[model samples]
Target: MMQCYGKSRVLTPTVVAAAAFALNKNRSLRTQSEEVGALDSWKKLWDTGMTRWHQRDVYWVLQKYGDDYIHKESRVLVPLCGKTVDLAYLTTKAKEVIGVEGVLQAVKEFMQENPNLQMEAVGSRNGFDCFRGEKIWLLCGNFFHFGPAVAGKFDVIWDRAAMVAINPSDREEYVQVLGSVLKPGGVLLLSGYVRPKGDVKSGPPFTLNKDQVLHLFEHQPWVASVECIESVNDAFSNEAWYKRLILRWRFGGVVSEDIWAIHSKAK
Candidate 1:
């Protein structure tokens, strides 16, 4: 395991209980070790290459709707950015791009792969290890530790899978943190997955329905509006049970959608 500057603590009961519930839905049980450690569990997933969620290229959301909303020379923020190649892509269009990641291994791998980045360590800020370059800044630490003072304001926030990956218990605070860093009238490009009410447990790729999305945004005063630009009923996995459930729940089947909503932070 890669050494993290920050200490790893046992997962809180709330988070463990949530994880256990999700695990139970899949008919699996977590060992005592897995139950106690949140960071280690995620670190193990990345270390073992279990990161199927990691996209090879920039997300479809950016390809499709980014140009429409994100202006050239804008400052863009990517939350929970897992060394996705999208960071490099963003640098081409944006004047500056900031990415926040929790894992040290992901940060190291990203820097190692992208040799073009003229990176220099900027030391720590609010507990995050910070690095800066010509067009990019990579912060390695817990995303929750990032504050407006540390992260500064941004004109664009590319929230691909970050929201869904968070534990439900922390979502409201997560949303608040997001709102704080965004400059007023900034663009927030968001996307995630949703599914029919099934026997399956909740997930890191958590189910986020349209209504839930609306509710989440509306509650935040900074969010001016949420226009769900696209939605489609789609397949989840190749599992036999998953396929059958899609057919059974035809009216409200499982699906993943790209949300290209334009959020204007309150002026």
Candidate 2:
């Protein structure tokens, strides 16, 4: 059997528990050893820095159609959603947002930004801080730990800094796991830089080739629409300056193939 855990000592019971829960729901993952380690490292390095990826314009871009496409009181799931500014957009559009981030620091910072939020500590595989807002509740924990108790149907998924987070191998599993949360017909908007292998050195802050991305989700029966918006930036570093593609994928939940496809024709 392949060793499931990485060499990082930071892997704790909380992390493993989250992994176990996620594993129980889905059986596909394409992550490499170093990539997983970098993700673990990236979570530890989070701070309230303005340069954080969550602060980028992608948040608003992802939510642009929300006013027309999404409904109120609809639950939205954000996986690997670390202090994602995108969560702010979902506030008025949806009833609750369950942001599954591996880091507690990001959750704390998110609470700090929204001081009016009444937050309560909750326990799970890796721990979670649930923020209750008048219209939104930001649940902090790894998405994997999001128990089956989260049964309400979500209208859309805001996947901003999520899919770009893992190594290339793991991207497929990321989609399936994330896709599992939304109710049929939910819209999924994913925006992030796709680093070609030549450019990226260190990342969570990582990379994904366009083809690999599309192949992961191309076949989902429920995907009604797919649109890709490509952008170029020096945000992380010039060496890794990339033309990113934002994939706006819609799931009608009508798939014979449980495996979701990127529907690149949206490009």
Candidate 3:
């Protein structure tokens, strides 16, 4: 069992907005624009104690799928992991766990939350501070700077809130980096939101439509297929609907060849 991060506190919308404004000058409204989106906005949210997105327990989607696909001794990677309790939960099940977070403060809070676990600075790589232990490794740096060489490859990838929380412009790069570290035939479990048509512009919790999800991985040779799609409830997407997208990577794939063969037969 892992140590709990204590109870969660509720914050008002006005307070959250005020903090965003006072803390980050780049973003004026609730969230940042895709092009001008800054990581400093998230850092401000963490420093100001406005992290309402943090969950009290394990995420519902993970609770539903982890046991079925993520087996014992499986290596797991959680990106942009901001003091997420899910990291600790994974440590209980997986042989090795790696968490990459852009904010240094979030990693510090996570270590403070788990006093029982021992953590030490392993070294610096790709301009990020890396910490390692027997079961877990936490890297404090830009998530994009991390790759297979920095963090090694993993069997499973968990995106509890990472994908939805990032800027739209960065989404493609995010997926690319994720694929680079994932082993062949690895599984990617994602939790995202589908909001009303206009709500996509209003986000740090960006709304992701089914078409967008499909299009994101449509031509990727690494993605074998989307295995499952399901609906669930989440605090961030309460007004909307939360969706889970499970993608399985191909092992020694020839997807391009298959596509070419089909097209040739049509001529």
Candidate 4:
């Protein structure tokens, strides 16, 4: 069984073995062409309906843990957000919800699909197409190019699948971009899958385990702490899209999904 750590927990070899045997196989299934940092690749994926990463509902992790940090007065930012329903859900919790996406098609689809939200074009800013609803703002442009100057700082950043999707080489730059817009004393809720040891490779959904997350953020001067709040074995096994990808990838191995709550130090 997967462990949920309110404080901290150790990962045993048995746990990894069990996860491998379960549905955690082939966690990093996207091809090199789908590298998310590349704007053209994301546009291609959205144009061709290869958006398996796009979840139909609000992410379960966010639903379960988000309330702890997100408040009615909080301003939330979702980076590299790809037409996720999570934005709609976030609009209810935070005073404002901002989603930065690279693909215009995905932005248009999000507006089209959530017509009930009444989101409409609000002109462009800094070259990004802007769409606004009551409490949600969707920016269609390069996420790396976006900063606090465009929309101001955020109290919380929800990074589900966003960090892991970037090429490992660009991770530092990605972190810088996220940190630049996050307010002092802000919280970042990050979720991603960890691959088995010694399997370093380029990936769209890269292997970003708990340890890497700690090393990436904990050492930063602005970061206060990085905590693994939740973890699950074979978390995506039941997803229909995961099942379909496994048949083609056939890269069986142990993979564990982890959710980290990284807090920025108060200035």
Ranking of all candidate structures by their lDDT, best first: 4, 1, 3, 2
lDDT of 1 at 161: 83
Worst 10 residues of 2 by lDDT: 250-259
- Quote each prediction's TM-score: 0.76, 0.64, 0.73, 0.84
lDDT (tens digit, per residue) of candidate 3 on 34-89:
32246787888899998866877787656766786678879999998988988888
Clashing pairs in 3: none
lDDT of all predictions: 0.70, 0.51, 0.64, 0.78
Give lDDT: candidate 4, residue 8: 43
Ranking by TM-score: 4, 1, 3, 2
Task: Evaluate model 2: give its TM-score.
Answer: 0.64
Number of the candidate with higher lDDT, 2 or 4: 4
What is candidate 2's lDDT per residue for 77-186, written digit by digit as tens?
77777766667766756777667766767877877776655555544433456656555565655554354455344666766656656665556556656555656556
Top model number, TM-score: 4
RMSD of 2: 13.0
In every candidate, how many clashes are there? 0, 14, 0, 0
Candidate 2 wrong stretches, greater than 4 Å: 1-40, 47-51, 56-58, 122-129, 145-148, 196-202, 229-267
Task: Compose the digit string of candidate 1's lDDT tens values, residues 146-242.
Answer: 7677878899999888888876566666776777778877867887577566422367667666666665666565666666666644534443544
Error of 2 at 71 (Å): 2.8
Residue-by-residue lDDT tens digits, candidate 4, 1-267: 455556743222222221221222133344445545478877888999999878887899888888899999999999989899999999889999999998899999999998988999989998688999989999988676677668999999999899888788667667767777888899889987776554547466788876677667754656667778878877676667667766326435555688888887677
Most accurate candidate by lDDT: 4
